[model samples]
Target: MEKSLIKPFIAKRVAQEFTDGMVVNLGIGLPVLCTSFLPEGIHVTVHSELGIVGQGPAPDEANADPMHIVDAGGSPSSIVAGGAFTDSAESFGLIRGGHVDAVVLGGLEVDQEGGLANWIIPGKRMPGMGGAMDLLVGAKKVIVAMEHTAKGNPKILKKCRLPYTAINCVNMIVTEMGVMDVTPEGIVLREYNPEFTVEQIQAATEAELIISPDLKPMA
Candidate 1:
């Protein structure tokens, strides 16, 4: 697929949340795309589960190396000139120790209360939880990026039917339609695309979304 078809806008927004020298972990799939959107001048440090730290931006097409395997996307990447290796044990230790500043991951469903259900599919019985359970508790901040709806059905629900990996773990969610923050009051609408409305988002979501008074169109 062409990169044009990808909604890096949300990725871009999530990347903006990053700061210089912060350690970030990118989950599989869409979250992996966030690396390509990072501003060139920033020296953000990236980490991968495959035991890599001091990771760099996504490589150019001609530069991409599938063997590198920084993230699931197989984007071109670079590591520290002399990096060390650790087993999943040590890798997870970094995650569980709260060393990760933020995590960007995809989601199957997110409830208004910030409950995240990214694994399993009810009667279907899909793959169970992966690192999400640990990341939820480990990462300082969690940003989820996913489509507002999946195959015309709302992924945001009042209650997750498939199964839940974590309850009230997400800090923010950026969908194709809008951006929402899990506030003390509720899921606050932080931003929305130009073509959508609060009612439109509400209609497409099974969960109750609290529209922020400052809700503005996406810039």
Candidate 2:
């Protein structure tokens, strides 16, 4: 087995998918890392369901504001210039009304058919599905940033074993091994990490993966 890219790099790769001036939501965990890797020269508005938009990266310990600013994950963050705060109702209204251009979320599993499963582990109790369900259905595009597998189990499966968050909602997935796009035909391997080969990725993935005609190195 090869050393796959780390979580931060995977989040960086996913951030490249964002276009200029898009209103994007970063889900908790890996998706939140996307904030630090956003491309330069493009102004993006970052929204959190916790009721803040135009937020920046997590603040340094010394500069952190204990009272006013924090991401949905409860990590201290800085608000970008012109950022505004709102209540949770208005926050979700922005999401459910289709105002968000894109959402990068962490997934426990994603099936070949583009279904997502991340809300719970089935047997264990979860904090509850916060806003993932709303974000999945409301965003103009949904990109999943997560590890390719978990404890050697392929998270990209032919069918998800865990409870699914949404069906056919994932537009693209950026994993440590590669980047895949979900198409009407199936999951297409678009880019792969330099450390792994197409065959290696196929072997690691349980779903039938289609190598894109234009497959390229992830770097």
Candidate 3:
């Protein structure tokens, strides 16, 4: 598949990480796509930092509610049954209190040490981070969903040159190229994308990686 197909591919893989009865925070952008690909038979409570919970996929053109319903990115969305709305303080309270089971966030750079740099790009003036820093510190599991490289540059780096969003907080990485886990030993390659060779992925990654003994293709 082409690079344009990577985000949703990674999002689908990230969706598999959720289990039944879990409260998950899906960050803006690509992470939001996971809501549309969640596996059947599992009940997940989706949280948005903009103060909404139990959000479903983006609504169709006819069903879109312009005034009241949306995700943090301001995209039109649907709310599930029994969903509740609250203020940002309360929303972050749930996150900071560790009530969240997992958080899937987009990333610009991730280091072998599990450090993340997603907020700023140095020299560019971007809006401040909404709640990613809080989510990184408090979520039980921090998963990053991004492409393996950016403009042909490796995003999995030996060390992030951009400003750090959170240090040593990432637990797993889901990229279009594969899925990897951050282990005490090193970054362990758990699965490889069938379309790409291990050598190709290794060549694209700047960090030292250890392929798992039982490595397989991503489901």
The better-scoring model by TM-score among 1 and 3 is 3
How high is the lDDT of residue 97 in model 3?
Answer: 92
Q: What is the C-alpha lDDT of each candidate?
A: 0.78, 0.88, 0.90
lDDT per residue (tens digit) for residues 130-190 in model 3: 7889999989999999989988999999899899999989999999989999977779999
Runs in model 1 with CA error above 4 Å?
Answer: 1-6, 56-78, 122-125
lDDT by residue for model 2 (31-123), tens:
877867878877689988889889877778999996888878777878888999999999999998999999999888999888999998867
Structural similarity to truth (TM-score) of each candidate? 0.84, 0.92, 0.92
Q: Model 2, stretches more than 4 Å misplaced? A: 1-5, 61-63
RMSD of each: 3.4, 1.9, 1.7
Report the CA-based lDDT of candidate 1 relative to the real structure. 0.78
Better of 2 and 3 by lDDT: 3
Number of clashes recorded per candidate? 1, 0, 0
Name the regions of candidate 3 deviating beyond 4 angstroms.
Answer: 60-67
Could you tell me which residue pairs clash in candidate 3? none
Ranking of models by lDDT: 3, 2, 1
Q: TM-score of the candidate numbered 1?
A: 0.84
**Order by TM-score, highest first:** 3, 2, 1
